[model samples]
Target: MGYRRLDKHILKAIFHRWIESQSISRIHREEGFDRKTIRSYIELFEAKGLRPGLQMPDEDLDCVLQELLPKNTRGRNKRELLAPYREELLRLVNPDASSGDPESPAERPAEVVRPKTAYLILVEKYRLEVSYETFKLYAREIGLTAQSKRAPTRLESPPGQETQIDYGTVGTLVDHHNGKARRVYAFAAKLSCSRLPFIQFTYTQNKESWMESNIAMVEFYGGVTECLLIDNLKSGVLKPDLWDPQINRGYAEFAEHYRTFIDTARVGKATDKAKIERLIPQARELFRRLKAIHPTWSLDELNRQALLWCRQEYGRAVHGTTGIAPMSLFEEQEQSLLKSLPPVRFEVPRYKPVKVHPDRFFTFEHKRYAMPENCRGQSFIARESGGILRVFDASYRLIRSYPVTEQRVCWLPGDFPKSREALMQGAYPRYLLSRARTLGPAAERLIDGI
Candidate 1:
């Protein structure tokens, strides 16, 4: 039957002989035709929205689902499946006896046992997941995700355990304080395991703000976190990764005082320290409302108002991503994490030594830069960062910094001394300004000023 010529009549005969509900492979076998002919006929029937030869199970559906949920979800789904208290919903509804104590992560306060939840413990067993919807779907299918499950994340710093930092845009509009406004970059911090968020506002997201914000965030978080996590914001981290991230030495030294490990999120990965990611959207929401009111004032005032707005509106609301209010979550998981709030919590960001020359200025592009006088005549290290110019003694102490780009700029500090030698700047001023007043009063005045 399989060798018979395939045609409409033969196909029709085969179709009638096989059951209407039979699979294509089964029908081909029963009808004595190859699967190719049967499948071709099925495709033709499907074009008209009619049943193809047979409706078959989709084996690839599982494959696609697995691919989509590959990162951490498979393990999460399995743990959720094998859990004991899988059906409980642990919402942070109203605080009763079960309501945990309020612990501010910035306090890095004393440790204590807080009121605990079934799913919070259950969630840990599954693995720390940021997306609740994704967690629940897999949990429902396999094991323990409750709709109201709380994830017990220790984002709060351990008496200086960890700091989370990022730069976010603050929306400003016409109605706002400054008639026209530019986006403000916010540097925020929170304890990693505890999750108490602190923020600072700055003019730009450049190296200055990048480091200053970290300084401010540490102060806001109540003390230095022993470890810090950040994105590859060129000003802060030159190279980014889970392992081997290159920290701007200037930023790394700042962390050293707090005895912290500086880690950066891997290229393209956002969930490395996701509690911070969850907090940033709320910052935009606050700015959106305040910017509409057109609150007018200095950058400081605007930031003050913005902070107040966040505390009032967003601080009390339950987090969209986490199942708990940020404040409440901070109080519960982070209080127990505080080690000993150190005495030295504040430090003005400082710079290191990079080298530049005296005769020819270092050019960071079209702009020329200047180093300290002491580095003069000798090969010296000059370090400039965060809107600061610091020339170092060979032993490496602060020297001097010139302000404003005048004939030079130093974008990447690493190339300072070496770049100064480039011959482009060595050329004398082209066509010295004649001043066009050789014998006149204008010439005399120019000479006097010079």
Candidate 2:
């Protein structure tokens, strides 16, 4: 009877009648099956609670029965076989056991319990005869190994209180004008209150790009939040700290201009800005779908499309958490709470520390700017602010300014004397001729000795 195999039709028929409370003899007669066969299948189903008159569905019962019947019953008895090594394995899993005094549990000092790898213990200590796979299976079955799952927690901020920002790569974007593919990055700013998001794309993530994007985001949102949350990007955050964070001077100055505070998330904690982290994946989906629809567009066109998507599609769509459209929520609840934009816009710039040349000049953007005074080889920070280069001393005081131009050399009126000797050493005759021309045509003819 144990070796007999019944067709699916017969097995199901017997299962239905058995569940209906029919006598075994009657089911055997009605289905034309031997009494013993009916009893066997009926017994199997009833044992697993597939009893008659139960409310469970037939499909679920069938699936459970299949799983129970086909499972191989032959295997090593893991618990019985590994019983001798149980104590040793437990000790390895909890090495702090040795640190505790054996005489009293109360005397045990606090210590970190490190989890030892199963392979090391098996190979070095036990030298178990079984394969690694078998050893691992036994360890799991005996509860020496446990897997943990992490649950993500979300945080919320009051309206107009905080904004979280981050940058993500958008893979390679083809430039329609040049027919060349360039890697692009997307910067996202999400308001913690309404989950309203603003996105902009750029070719690079330098200080200038970051600052410009931030300004654009605030302007687009119509106001700035009280505090701006950002990751440890070198463009904005100089050093990440739990209590006191160090922000880049330029970024700090920019924030000050907007009357907003900068808050940096702890290093390596994405949950600190969970709102932005959650929006990134959804933004990527939008980017992919938009790219497919257009295929090739200039950065300006792509940005236009992004703005439309943010306003028309994402903003108007109901959020999963709040059950209200982001744009509606922002306009109704968060907009009024935000701080108004400042009167004057901040001019963003790239900053770098440079040493004054022996000739009292510093090079930036392939052009030289003569220092206003003799810095005498001292270090200074040069701010390449748009069309102008502003030089600041160690104290960040403005000491020199020059227009960034195509000229190979530029000089301040006060700096010509400091560089005069160096220029003469290189081209004394030419320098004299140039200086003569600057004076007048009469001086030039006189210097020519005509």
Best by TM-score: 2
TM-score result, candidate 2: 0.62
The 10-residue segment of model 1 with minimum total lDDT is 89-98
Residues 1-450 of candidate 2 have per-residue lDDT tens digits of 235455556677777788788898899778887887677777677678676777777788677666545444558864355667654555445434444454665544212111234334444455556565666676776565656545357797889999999998765677776878888788998999898899887889998899999999999999999999999999888887889888898999899989999999989999899889876755555554455445656778878878887887889999988899989999999999999998888888779888878877777777776775558788999888768888888788998787888887787554566347556347666667777899999999888774
lDDT of 1 by residue, 1-450 (tens): 334555445555554444266777778677776787677665644553445354434454233223322143144554444344322221121122122334634323221111122223334544454354544564455433324534334343344356677777654334344466555666665556544566656667766567666665555444565567787888888776666877886677776766677778777766666777866755654444343333455667667875554454445678655666666765566545544455755344444333365653554334555554444556445555455555556666655465544544443344344334343445222212233355677765666565
Model 2 pairs in collision: 19-52
Highest lDDT: which candidate? 2
